[model samples]
Target: MQRRSFASAVSAAAAAPFLMGAAPSGGDTPASAAADKRLKRDMVASLEAELQDRDTARAVAAWIYDIGFDWTPATAPIGAFDFLIAYAFGNRPPANGGDPTKVLAEPGPMNELLADTVAQVRAKRTLPVYAQWEIAHFLTEKYNMSQVIAINPVIAADGTITYLSTDGVAAQIAEKRKSTPGGVGTAGVVGWRDHIKRCVLTTEGRGMKAFAPEGFTMPDTYDPESGQPWTRRRDLYLVHDMNAQWQMKRTELVARMYPNG
Candidate 1:
């Protein structure tokens, strides 16, 4: 069957919140181009150096996954594919979420698949390339998802695992979310809350060392069981309590940056 384009799906999903009267007006602050350029340079340099050592490359990829999966806030659709594209390509905004001229231009379709894929991977942490290809096809042919599955795999040493493929990971996450008890909507919300509190907020306040690396110093203000600085945890709870209100306003901003399927 024919595959759907990314832009179409995004456009459709982007309209959902607005149609529901849940989305607000306004766009997210796009990341600074200069900062993005610098980050790209640093990341390329880091990846280049690490790739020379096979073990190091694997470790780095694993680290990327840990930080990525850990820190991503569970608020609304997080646009994991968009985030990866922005990070990988650097300094270039896609014509419509991804490069239109190159391929994967259909924003609405691609993002719908992306949203579904993220939900899947967040649950199972694994997937196959063919499955994702099928998903891309299904999205295009069946659901008008997106036609972008242009990424190459970052294979493991034993060759039994594939660590990086935006579409593949997404399919895994989407499948997991489907089987989840509360369903995609509730799981996404709850996951985002947990991620925000456990990952983003904590990392922002302290750093990555808190959870990984045995010698990592614990913040004097942190409680072992609670996983946050005492002062910050209290503040986060208050903030989290207000998240529903905040998200209602923020969804529009995120949608503007992401658009939808």
Candidate 2:
């Protein structure tokens, strides 16, 4: 699809209200549930078509909008952080000849990765990139990337970071676009592969012309005993995919149930 048509589709999807029907409740009939399921499926299909469109993927945007992931105090950084680093550095080969598993197993490799990422961002990026949640804060401090704008994360008095919902992040981006002078209305939504479709939907739902290119996949580790890869990351991918489905359905349901609100 052409960029103009894509933008129109996004706007129409964002502005379109839910098909009116009996809302689901505790005493809802099977028919109502079936209707709900069909509605959700149709919405998913529409969003997926946009995501899978080659022209949509190739469409250039003024800003790269990275959706954040979990960042605990103990873990410090998560898979999405690695994705952000890789994107900033243009996914260049690691000094260890592009082996991600080695980068994971080797000591001090992550530090080196950070240093290289910082250098790349500083050299290549002319403007501050927008990243949601605590990843933005962590990237700024650790990579010395003063060029990252963090959106909608709460930092407590004790320094604990509380991240907001994906919808919240999308809404904030929409508001920012409206406020900025001569701001480009399009953005490239970035996140895990399983999560990117939902992110793009939420972004478009907020009236931003957004498309998700191929998302970054986290490297999986092998099982020590079976020598099988993706032992743990398999579960992670499944959980993320399921959660993405639920979140997308819930957003539509909420909008339908509270049409006036």
Candidate 3:
């Protein structure tokens, strides 16, 4: 029900890419940053080159839809919903899953749809609560990834309610941090990190199974406060759109791999 602030969103976007390995660390020199940007541009161009053929688009779309549910956006920007649909169906798969080449195609209907949804949200002044519900609906209906919906609780017009899973609560907490100023280092972030460490990293939350994919396993150790161990649970925790930093990294990678056009 609460709306996220613009500043918090920007911070999340900036931090996410670094956490996901999409960008060079803040310590990089200006030349290195420029080179990285150039590489991303080239990657985008290459993908567009391949997508000149319509047949490629359809093929890429099908493959992306199939695997995207399990794909973590933290690993790449290809999970930007619309971009994923265009790239996998348009371009051939890269040797590595993180290849930007697969996502260089022009925007497709999926992109349009996402754009429209965002527009509507903005036009109607939709709050974060609404966005959360929309995300839950999208994940459940489109991908059959029930886990997404399971983690998000919903309140009905009639005052009835649907409960979200523990992981869902964790996600909400993460979203909150992304929407709040200095959230990544705030008490909320620390609390969420501790929750994951205790729940996903320790045996207590494991047996409860409130937030993981069915049959998902947790890692033996983690750096929850720092985003490490790269476990399945950690990936799930990091799977938030509010993390703009991650998104920027993904965009940069896409641009680097397909620059020129």
- Steric overlap count per candidate: 35, 0, 36
Model 3, 14-116: lDDT tens digits are 4343323344443468786667556444443454478773333333333232233222211111111111010000112223435232222232222233323
Question: Per-residue lDDT for 44-108 in model 2, tens only?
Answer: 45554778642232221100111122110111112212122111111223346444433322212
Clashes of 2: 0
Give lDDT per model, in order: 0.32, 0.44, 0.32
Cα-based lDDT at residue 82, candidate 2: 17
Tens-place lDDT digits, model 1, residues 1-261: 123345435444543332233222122223443343344345435765866643333334333333332232423233221111100110112344542333332222322333354334433322222123323443345544332333333444654423233224334444444554544322211112222234322222221111211111112221223312221344454344344334533554466656872
Model 1 TM-score is: 0.22
lDDT computed for candidate 3: 0.32
Locate the minimum summed-lDDT window of 10 residues in model 1: 82-91
Candidate order by decreasing lDDT: 2, 1, 3
Better of 2 and 3 by lDDT: 2
